[model samples]
Target: MSLHIVGGLLIKRFGKTGIRSVNLLRFRLAQEFLLCFILTKNTFGKIINKTMSKKPSRFHVDESDLWCKNQCGFYGNTAWKGYCSVCYKSLTNRQQSSSHRVHQHASVEKAVSQRQATPELSYSKFADKRRQQSKTNPVKSLFKSTKKDKSEVDKTSSKGHHHLKSEFGAFLESLSRPIYEDISKRVQNFLSKFKLLPVNSTVETWSDAVQDFYQIITEHINVDPIYQTLEETAVENLQDQLEMYLMNRLYNVVFCPPNSNDEQEDLSLQKRIRSLHWVTIQQLEANVNDQDIGVRIALDKSIADIIELDTKTLPKDKLACIVESSRKIFDAFRLSNEKSEVDGGPQSVASADDFLPLFIFIILKANPPRLKSNINYITRFASPSRLNSGEGGYFFTNMCCVVDFIEKLNAESLNLSEEEFDSYMSGRTTAEGVNTVYVCDGLRLIHENNGMIRRLKERQEKYANSVLNLEHKLSEFREQFDEQINQLVLRAPLTLKPKRGKADIDLDHDIPHSLPSPILPQQISNSQI
Candidate 1:
């Protein structure tokens, strides 16, 4: 308080100009410190006196001088080359040189003469010494002080390189943060809903949940502001990365491979899971289109994963699981049609045509057997038009093309009798000689579609012919009306009246007269008039 009063008095006496004076500021600061020290001097006087009276330990002198300080003219102990920090590099090199000479020559004099004459040998020995120096332990070997320095250089270089790499990786991740966060939020929402279902849920239950989740995902992508804000190339790159991440998440969770177990309940659960997988595939297919290229690519990868995983686990671990894979193909077909009835997906019925055949082709490729059952399945359900066009035909033809290849690579032969072959190709007969296979759903559907196509063509031709006949009738009616009009004009009688300044000519006048008259006979002949 006293120091502040004194500083304020000094500042007030000089006014604002005193604040700008460095000498005044310094004098007042010194005065404040002098006053503070004077007030606290007696309080700390005893402690200061005691601290000043104490002293450090005294140093002792050695009676005999050490070799390092006396001989090497240094201040410390002589552990290496009579000096504390000195190294015996030349001494170690001499030892290595002597060892090499001992191995290469019988006498020291000849060895020295050879080494002197051959400069390459001395240079090689020096290079070897340098290399050994670089490798020697820094703490244990006195001759290798350079090794410590080189090791530190290497460590710093590696650290800097690793830092640059890590910084670059962090930069890339920062650029993709928006896309990553968006996909991560969506995946979390999906997994949250997925967890709501019980572990033993039925295929139908899981299918409904998955369908809803797929709809949400597509809607999120379509309406995302980030997609709208980015350029086309940037959008595609982000989409590629986002889809890879999303597919990875999905493959691990919803579409993960079923665990193998011999329990009956587990087997039943496996069947339900397989069914759910097919439904999920159909759902994915429904959402995939030209505008959804990311989704389409992701779907393809997911399908490949499912196929590879399933193929590795089925039918006694044999790679030939396609021999009896017709049932599952049929199930996918039925599921698609059933879904179509409910308007379950985003795809139209035409878009859904390839779903069954694609998986069928995958199965056949994985395990190539006789093409009989597969051919029947293809010809049965899919119409010729649908099977021959688009992706459907690609897989269909590939299956057929591989048939010859499979035959050439055959390890086992296919055996079938004439009766059996006929039965397999055509419909099977019952004990009553009735062909029960006629009622097969697949065949019936194909027949119905073929009949519909034929009917459509017939109706088109009939419409064209009717249009032609109608045009012909219109022309005939026009001609008949013209003829009737001409007959009316010919049947009517003709007459001529005299003009104001011209003579009248009436052939119907029986009495000839030199003067022309306006009046004439009541009846006039048509030809004369």
Candidate 2:
């Protein structure tokens, strides 16, 4: 029943009651309202509990539905694209294996077919088969012989070392003057265009100008009568020579042009590398024999060679130095490996991973002057074919990568603590109480000291030799002087002449007795005696 209707009926039935009876009726109504509220709350709560119990929970998924679609009897995961992780991995692996097997079977069949197609021969038929093969493969045989002859010719040519004669003899004889003049004219024209407004110049423009210049020169060489008689390699060498000549002339203007920031970058990179001088081979995890004297010498030589890069006038020579330095690093690694092998360790060749860190270390130590400018110059002016492949390109790329790495290097990159790195960079004592000196600084100090000692020793030896030589010369001179004096004495011997007295005067020859005769005061003389 509704609470309002019940309360209204109770109020009507108790309408004639007194204040006490009315108060009791009101109390009964309050109790009835309280009881209704409690019963309704209990019923609603039960209903809600039932509804919630009937609803499915996210955690209680059905097992059959959760099973892998492949029926592998394992639970599936959304992460695995509805397949079990194990089954998914197995499926992928099986697919890969099957594909690999198919490829292998195909390759095997192809090999078998090739083998079956070729006829097997005994010694008896070998000569006949060879004759038939030669008859059938005349061009191939010719190519083989040609290749052999070419290789032999290359070997012979390389054996005869002539700095300028062998490579550019023809050019130097006839083509050099005209070619140089043309290159000079072209360079002059090109420079005229950008010499004044260098800020407007771009690398692309410069590259295009160079490329065009090269093309023109190449055409000129090709059409020249002298070039026709030259061998293909000679022609190529001539072209290379011309390129070098042209680049050397252009290097001053094109390399690190006034508007470019190559110099600034070089200085920045140098400073960064100097800061990272404390990065040891161990920190870089470079595979080098730091303790081996030979390896250390090689690395030091490489550092010196890399430093010489700035001094090289030609890009080729600079590239040669880079290649030499890289080779030295490789040799160092090889030496290390050999030493390790001698110590009963496994032997291995140096790989790119091993090369990079050591190269980085070398750069840090060498800190070549105008490094960025050199790199930029080479990249800009070097033959594309040279820089795209071969040792030059590879090592130059590594050098570039090393520079970049140094630029971006930090404590995290070196796997060092920030505090330690800071201490090293600041040249301060670390927590370990060890002051960090850069590798270059320590090496330079050692080198200077050793050089000083060597020079001092040489000076000492030279001074000793000089003193002995002087003493020997002095002895010879003294003996000569003594002999001359003896000869003089012998030639004009000293004779004792009799002392002439006044009484022994020859009156006619020794004295003019008749010239004048003055009378002496004999009395004064007798008194003085």
Q: Which of the numbered candidates is closest to the native, going by highest lDDT?
A: 2
Clashing pairs in 2: none
What lDDT would each prediction earn against the true structure? 0.42, 0.67
Model 2: which ten-residue window has the lowest total lDDT?
A: 136-145
**Model 2 over residues 217-287: C-alpha lDDT tens digits?**
66776787645666788767766886765565456556776556787988887888777656677777775
What's the CA RMSD of model 2 in angstroms? 38.7
Q: Can you write out model 1's per-residue Cα lDDT over 270-298, one digit (the tens) per residue? A: 33323222112222232113123233233
Q: Residue 287 of candidate 1: its Cα lDDT?
A: 19
**TM-score, predicted candidate 1 vs. hidden true structure:** 0.22
In angstroms, give how far residue 413 of model 2 lies from its true place.
Answer: 2.1
